[model samples]
Target: MMEFRMKRISRKFSSVLAVISIIIISVMIFSYGCVKKEEKEITIGAVLSLTGKGAKYGEAIRRGIELALEEVNAEPNRIAKIKVVYEDSLSEPQKAVSAFNKLIEIDKVSVVIGPVLSNEVLACAPIANLKKVVILNTSAGTEDLRKAGDYVFRNRESAIPQAIKIAELCRTTIGIEKMSIIYSNSPNGKDYQNAFMKRFEELGGKILQIENYKDGETDFRTQLLKIKESHPQGVYLAGLVTELAYILKQSKELNFKTSFFASAGIEGSKLFEIAGDSAEGVIFGSPAFDPASNEPLIRNFVMKYRQRYNQDPDFFTANAYDALKLIAISIDKAGYSSEGVKNTLYSIKDYPGVGGTTTFDSDGEVIKPIRIKIIKGDQFVSFEKQEK
Candidate 1:
């Protein structure tokens, strides 16, 4: 009878152990299912000039976007997997419109990043506003882009700040009292010209001469000769990089020794490659792009960009990178809806970006510090106020 009692007690203990095991297994399965269900996905679209005239800008933007997407995906606590679909705008206005439509209609993307040039953005902005979609323009810095509507936001500041800064640097740092302006007869060039002239005159500088040339014009001997005859202390050239390079080469041919100031348009390698020796000592205002910045965010981005592209990141790439980061941040805060993203964008402030800390202003424009860089020797260096 004692042996029977011992066996019965052992059986009861076994039954309790099995019931606990089932309960633990049930809880484990439920937790696993919950985790699987929590995984989310989002799709963003990019409409860039992937080919034709604006290909270089598009390529930089694409690289930045891809880098941001990778970094976001690798975050251990990230709830959503982000993806970007790209459409080539060919740097044409109509093509940009079509690309924008395709991204919204076909890909069903509520947010898009791109159409890098001003004209492309202008072309696509109306449609975006109509559809109530959100657009984060990476590098379109034209003055009129600020009026593109509430749904459109740009990562880079408008050309006005660079113009003002360039003028200030020329007058105060370079000690220039008189300057000449040569600009392209395009919207981009016209905007820079107006802004610079207004700011320079306001700062007590004399505008000795103003000249304009049509876009794609290779020969600038006439304009350069006219500018040289003005006897100005400096010259500000505002136009595309290729044109700027040719103008520089021709200015050199004319033995013009005046200081040279360029628009942010001259931010690429093409200017140096084509102008060669003429590019030395040329100063321009760009969104700050110092890879040696103390901010770890900037340092890491610089390192990753260099590692992936095997080249130094420029202001354009930095702007695109900031745009992507802002978009991701908006998505996290506002969910995957277009209206949510648009609302969050306006509220973003002090966003630490590789370009600079960005704060979106009331007009959907970005406000950030612009750096004055001089091409010293073979590289661009930030111009210090104390440096002679």
Candidate 2:
């Protein structure tokens, strides 16, 4: 009886061990099933200022990108839905680099949209090149950024065209033989000043004086007074709209009545709002102006922007919208692969955009139309359109 009782106890213990082993195997299988493997998605990244001095511009760009994605997703036959992630660069170089690193290394985005400022773009270029991520810039116009890497692409014309346009205007329309340059000492400003000076001198235009103001400096009365004393035939303001407005208002106050030919700084409506009547008659180089442009895409975009934001789309916003569409089109044409997209984008020739027909050269700088716009009665009126 003792032996039989011991045998029963052993059988029960073995049964319990078997049950426990079965449960352990089941749990292990369930956990293994629940473990996530690496999944791939169509990822794109954007680095915009969004919250700093250039917030308005950044917000507009972000809105444009969002709208493009919304449209692409709404299509039933869409190739593959893109997942766009954004980081605020604050228009700073280091921050821009960090944003690029996060997008490339962390998010694994195949394509990147800009750090809008030229300096920030330049800072982020090396990283994009190293990571083999395609970068498309909407607004950074520094000539050097275009040549930063083979993967770098831009939708906007650089300051060189604007400088040449202004030089032509100064020589012909304004009848200015001698001119003075009042430029902010930022990278973009300095780039515009240098390009304008070089082109103006090349065009046989004389430089009466050149003055530089540091960025974020509110006081330009001293600069205005100096420009006034120089008595230039025309004054080229090479800065963002804020500084340009200050210079214009101060020029008016200081009785400096030199006809102004500006760079792309005066492309937005905010310039007119900031400078009021003082902004009138100011000729600036722009990509194109079509309050009544016939392009259906532009018309649709303008209508949508007005309906949603209750404001007209500026050149920058238009460029941003086109930038996203260009990327989308490239991806679609390339069959949703990174190499295909890059190769297709490089192969894109004479792709018509809202701004104009854009063709990427060997260096990826977009060759497109550049226009000259004159501010007339609180509106930008196109004065000239040069087709490349």
Decoy 1 TM-score against native = 0.89
Model 2 Cα lDDT, one tens digit per residue, 183-230 = 877778888899888877887888988999876677899888887888
Cα TM-score per model:
0.89, 0.85
10 residues in a row with least lDDT, candidate 2:
33-42
lDDT of all predictions: 0.86, 0.80
User: Candidate 1 overall Cα lDDT vs. reference?
Assistant: 0.86
In lDDT terms, which candidate is top?
A: 1
**Residue clash pairs of candidate 2:** none
